[model samples]
Target: MDFTPAIKLLNSCNTVLILSHHNPDADAYGSSLGLALALRGVGKEVVVANQSGKVGRFSFIPGFAEVVDKIAVNNPELIVFCDCGELRRVGERFEQEIKTIKCSTINIDHHATNDLFGSVNLVDEHASSTCEIVYNLLRDAKIDIGKEVATALFSGISGDTGSFQYSSTTEAAFRVATELVAFGADAYFVACNLWASRSLAALKLEADVISNLKSHCGGRLVEGLITEEMYNKHGVDSSEADFIVGRLRDIKGVEVAVLFRKEDDIWRVNLRSKSTALDVSAVAAKFGGGGHKAAAAFRSKMELESFHDQVIRELMDLFEG
Candidate 1:
């Protein structure tokens, strides 16, 4: 879709609602809030709402404290969704709520798996981040990229690309980052706060996860488990275990890295790949999960050991095939 008409529509809407998916990551909140602030800069009444609550670490991003939840969603002239591919991922409860709306809707995302469910889908699977899409939209509409907007966009870009370490980091991403910096985005501050400020509990979880690491396929694939017992022993929550998989991926000769954590009665699998031939999202989609090619996740009903075996078998088949 040509974003021109929707940009014009945005200029006319008095009240606009911006939304992201459930358990939103940095890119989701960043893109949503960036667009919200940009719209507000042009005198549009915009609300940034997500299906879930705050993502603790990313609350440092400006406008995060003011995020509206699903309950706050009211009838509005315009609806814009960011970083979410499909309405169902936003939360099944709000899918119909979103569909029933009769106004012009805009869907912006960077996921290759996007459902293209929007009346005006601005899905760019090649873009490194949704913030990039939003940035281009604002530029195409001739909107100014002020400090707040630049900061938010930078956060989304930096966070999703793993602070520019991931393979998705392209020349365009760096060019946008440079422009955002010129617009007064504080890269150092965001980098320090988001990555360097880990709690002791998180450190302990990291150590435990590393200690339990297992390798297979001649060190090409690595796996780690952070069980409930391990969490209790370390006195840390599962959220603190978020970065453990990165450590496994750091090991030399490891092409694929996976971490399995017990969340209540379910098993959550985080998958990462360093090889272009491997599409981790394909592995994730088998179990109803979806994400980018390099990084993907899925949830399973099987027990940890059972799920571990199943995943290993599947991965072995992929490697052998």
Candidate 2:
């Protein structure tokens, strides 16, 4: 996708409000905060907001503390959405709030299922992550990327690509990382904080998930469940268990891994696949959710048994066909 339109739109705007998906991951916060910092450096008034508010684990990244739950800017000239596949991914509350704002919007994302909802869409499905696209945008616009901006952008790129271990890590991703490092993005600092800083409670939660793992389809499919009771037992929230699905996917002979996290009356299902043939995003879309081919998710209100059976059937169909 062309960046000219988005570059022009951003240049003309004075105040910008940036948002990302709800229950955000590293890519979401990294892309949003990186662009917000860069825009502020250029004298544009910027406010970084998310429906879920600030994530505690990401506080190491600069400007993480400044992210707000409320829209701080009044009648902003522009709104940029980063790392979101669709508008509703910002959550029901913010989705409704955004509709009241009448301004030209820019959508910057790397999700294959992006809806091109922005007035100026900069969706590049081939890019490794949204942070990679944002880096190019800043470079093309001749905006100076200082150390803080580099760290923010690098964190997102590192996160979405799974620290360059995932298949999405392209040659361009490496080149961008090299440049960001030269700009003083502390690679070691990011790695230590993201990977090595898991709390004891999180580790306990992981152990519990592993012990109760359910195998299906001859071990090609594995699923883990986390309930409110488990959270209370471990003293950790769903964010702490983000690593559980990845661990499940790492098991030998497993093609797909599923994680069911209970939140109130709904269960948020996260899906991860090791084989490209699986296309988990298609499965997610059946339940009104969308993401990349390898990683996708949706929420369900069905009873635990019914939801588990439905998901198993879907995976079985994909595997057998």
Model 2 poorest 10 in a row by lDDT: 312-321
TM-score per model over all chains: 0.93, 0.98
Could you tell me the TM-score of candidate 1?
0.93
Q: Write the per-residue lDDT of candidate 1 for residues 128-215, one digit (tens) a residue.
A: 8999899989988989889888988999999888899988899999999899999988999779877888888888878877887889
Candidate No. with top TM-score: 2
lDDT of 2: 0.90
On the 0 to 100 scale, the lDDT of residue 183 in model 1 is: 90
CA lDDT, every prediction?
Answer: 0.83, 0.90
Q: What ranges in model 2 sit over 4 Å off?
A: none
Candidate 1's C-alpha lDDT?
A: 0.83
Question: What's the true lDDT of residue 15 in model 1?
Answer: 90
Tell me how far the alpha carbon of residue 134 in candidate 2 is from the true structure, in angstroms, after superposition.
0.3
Local lDDT at 205 for model 1: 79
